[model samples]
Target: MAQTKQTRGACAFCGRQMTGNGMVKHLSACPKRKDTLGESNPKSGKEEKIYHLKIQDAWLNDFWLHLEIRSSATLKDLDSYLRSIWLECCGHLSQFSTKGHLGEEIAMDSEVSALFHPGLELTHIYDFGDSSETLIKVVGEREGTPLNEHPIYLMARNELPEVETCACGKPGAWLCMDCTESEDEVALLCEKHAKDEQHQDHNLMPIINSPRTGRCGYAGPADPPY
Candidate 1:
């Protein structure tokens, strides 16, 4: 597969930017994170078992996320979050399974604590027909006060992957579905070319930060949970 340019994203807590691998190490020892954990806010909830999860597009290494979720949260909660942030275009069926898409199906109501462990990995498949698969791994766990009222907290995520420009040597921000379907060549286009007389007849999809980009009605990600 073709590789995307190296990308960096900001830490939700301190706004410090780092590469994906670098963010993993940084999150574990970030001073701001430590400080947040140390704060004794009266509004904080009781201690709970929180699991650190690493979620990544199964095919694209460039699209990924690090999350801390309360073990009490159900698989449904995780699924809902995934939909809101990345996959919900049409209300398509989704499932969490053991091996891959054909693996043992896990119930949506199952709690995180019931299924997750230090090294457990699961596959989440959305839109069975034009599916987007994500690999979810239990990176680590800790007993601590819940970060907020939400069942999960976003720690970090990958910045958008960079794409090659159009034939005109300008940035490509649109994709021509006709070209993609034909598989003759990449359909990336700059705004100018997207509206050009020769290209305007083809169906166009905007470039977005998602593995689902140009696929089955996916427009883009919803506002992230920070």
Candidate 2:
């Protein structure tokens, strides 16, 4: 087995690529971001608030994203963005919930300004049966910017998860679900190898970009409609 490659991402401010944690550290010191942090308001004049968000798969920390968005935006906007970027597979229903208020779930139309604050954490569950849960935290908040008009802006994201290489050295593109008895012999195959007779009835699943991959009917989204 080869060593798994570390995940990397580009700084939204400088476009310099670094590890997930590295980008978090870099954003605090990014010169470009710093310059904007000092500016007061955008010409639009509507009061704005910048919210820093950290989102990750409830089951796997490797699939995650850091975002900067306007507090005025609605959960619907966030839902749309999330669907576009990762979770939209079968038009499943989703919702956000705070700790004790689980029964009082917030709908997609809920405004961020009304429900979120620094230090607040929420859970997002997509699809009721084969659900994909995401842990979300509102890490910071400040006066917003002209860029806030973008609804949702991606600041950083985890690099793709690492996996074993195929016999030919190509990265594994499929994982066979039928070989669970032999953990060491579990099949991780590239496209060409996946077509072999041994894998015909094994229920092959493609490795994909979303944390929802291999769950329910999710297979990642098309381009963002925004």
Candidate 3:
């Protein structure tokens, strides 16, 4: 397999950019996050188990996210979040299942507390046709007050992967769906060639920071939860 370029993303807590594994380590000991946790006002509810999950595009390793979610949240909550941030297009059906357990579909209502544990992995499939698959791993868990009232907290994400431009070799900002269908042609294009005679009539999609980019009707990511 060919190696993809390593990309770095900013920490949601401190805005410091780091590579995937580096972000994982940084999140575990992020001082800003620790301080925020310590400074939160005590609430009436008992502390709950907050799970740390690592989600990544199954085939595109460069697109990934680290999230902190309360065990009280349901699989449906995760599904919704994933759709909003990465996969929603045409209101398609999606499902979660044990990563290697064939045909074992996890219920959407299943609570995180019931389904997750350190090292456990699940696969999320969106849209039966032109599907986008994501691998979710239970990185670890901690007992703590729920961070805000949201079901999940964005912790870290991978920066957009770098892609080569068209045959012209200029910076690419658009993808031509028509050319994409032809095995011999390059689909990526710069602003100039994207409007050139050959590609002007082609179905063009903006090159955005998403695994679903250039697939189905995905335009770009929705706004971040934070």
Using lDDT as the measure, the top candidate is 1
Q: Is candidate 2 or candidate 3 better by TM-score?
A: 3
* Model 1 C-alpha lDDT per residue in residues 123-216, reported as the tens digit of each score: 9999989889999988778888878888888998887787878889998899888877453366799999899898868888887777778778
* Colliding residue pairs in candidate 1: none
> Global lDDT of each model?
0.84, 0.73, 0.83
User: What TM-score does structure 1 among the candidates reach?
Assistant: 0.92
Give the TM-score comparing model 3 with the true structure, all chains together.
0.90
**Per-prediction TM-score, please?**
0.92, 0.80, 0.90
What tens digits encode model 2's per-residue C-alpha lDDT throughout 1-226?
1224556767777788877656666877789877765663566346687788888777677777888778778998888788788788888888988773254687788888888898888888888887878888887776746454577778787756787787789889887767534535656788888888888887777777667656556555534444
**Ordered list by TM-score, greatest first:** 1, 3, 2
106-128 in candidate 3: lDDT tens per residue?
Answer: 99999998878899999999998
Where does candidate 2 stray beyond 4 Å? 1-6, 35-47, 100-104, 167-169, 177-186, 197-204, 222-226
Model 1: runs farther than 4 Å from truth? 40-44, 181-184
